[model samples]
Target: MSETLLQLRNVGKRFGDHVVLKDINLDIAKGEVVCVIGPSGSGKSTLLRCINFIAPPEEGEVIFEGRTWKRFHSAFNFIANRKYEAKLPTLRAEIGMVFQHFNVFPHMTAIENVVLGLTKVRGNTRNVAREIAERSLRQVGLGDKLDQYPEKLSGGQKQRVAIARALALNPKVMLFDEVTSALDPELVTGILDEMRRLASDGMTMVVVTHEMNFAFQVATRIVFMDAGRIVTIGTPEEIRNTTEPRARAFLSSILG
Candidate 1:
């Protein structure tokens, strides 16, 4: 088995008085693709954000590589009041995230967008970043559109560019939060196809999506979440065939 690349222990989060997550624990092995499926308000996106430190958990340990760090704590207790901090830049570099809305800079061309992070964060020279950006764009099947601006690209193309930007970081794991949810139905497949290609190439990924067919087809494990906790974790076959009440109800609702 591959080494565990990421671990979450006793993770919990709340916004004001609303609890969003509770004692969540999960381990993601290197090269494994785990898909998270749940209804809206189930904390799926919040969980992904916590992994990348976009939304720090109120209480938990987020372990990446060999180092572990607390992501958050109560502000009331002096000991726990200290803001959770770690090697954020390094950690963020190791885990690339693609948001639901393509956050690409509108002023930059596809290739330029991909090169921005490499140059700014990794401090690679412009020439080197451009070369790497081109290669990454090609990997996402966007070689011909490298010079296209965001306004000129389709939704799928823009998302692919975003993916290329993330890939340019050479991350070990990728977190995708409903990446296809905003695309038109006709454009969704192009982005998904790129994701399928990435998965086939052994890029560890954690995706939160509502597309059951895609989850069954691409993920090694499917995790179902509800009411701020994991309800089931299993292979696609187990998820489809299980008699668990939550699983059945969720499947019935989505598949209906």
Candidate 2:
């Protein structure tokens, strides 16, 4: 365990009349891996979105690195709204997120795809950005594919390129939203191994995953959510042995 790097305080979210997150409170420590699990529609993905203000929460506060942000509502004051929007790029950069899809540009080479953000948002010189991009691709075992386009790479390789793009930004925390769900079964291992290496290197990660074995083995803590609320939070052993009915049902359904 390390110092708390991100905090969600009494967070809640809704889409129309239906609630997606209910007073969700969580603390993510630096150098820790926290696996968020439960059935689909349990707000796992929404939770990640809220953390990075993708779809900001409807209620409560998010505190990252000591800066506090309240729920983002459309009806809020215009000045506050503009300020919120202004901070998003920097916020999102520190909180790198990868999605279920690779989302790489088909026309760009892997390195070029990674360099896009570095040059645009970060304002790095092209040569400096390229060097950083090259190192990041190499970090993800994709040094040889720097010139390859998304259409020319396998699903896993494309995912690696996406990951390299994130790493090039040097984010403080990484949010993985079902990153391996779309990959072929055989290709999944390579991505999982990359994540494992990140965990071993002490990168703080919040992962929404259905991979029970990886959750059990790698997580410093596990969060079990159900029907828009966190039903349990504990180390893998505590969660695995939880008596909470909703959590037990989820674990049995998935892990059995």
The C-alpha lDDT values of all candidates are 0.90, 0.92
- Candidate 1, residue 126: lDDT: 96
RMSD of each: 2.5, 1.4
Top lDDT model: 2
- Candidate 2's displacement at residue 104, Å, is 1.7
lDDT of 1 at 163: 97
Off by over 4 Å in 2: 74-80
List residue ranges in candidate 1 displaced over 4 A. 72-86
Residue lDDT tens for model 2, 70-99: 765468599887877888777788888888
Model 2 per-residue lDDT at 200: 95
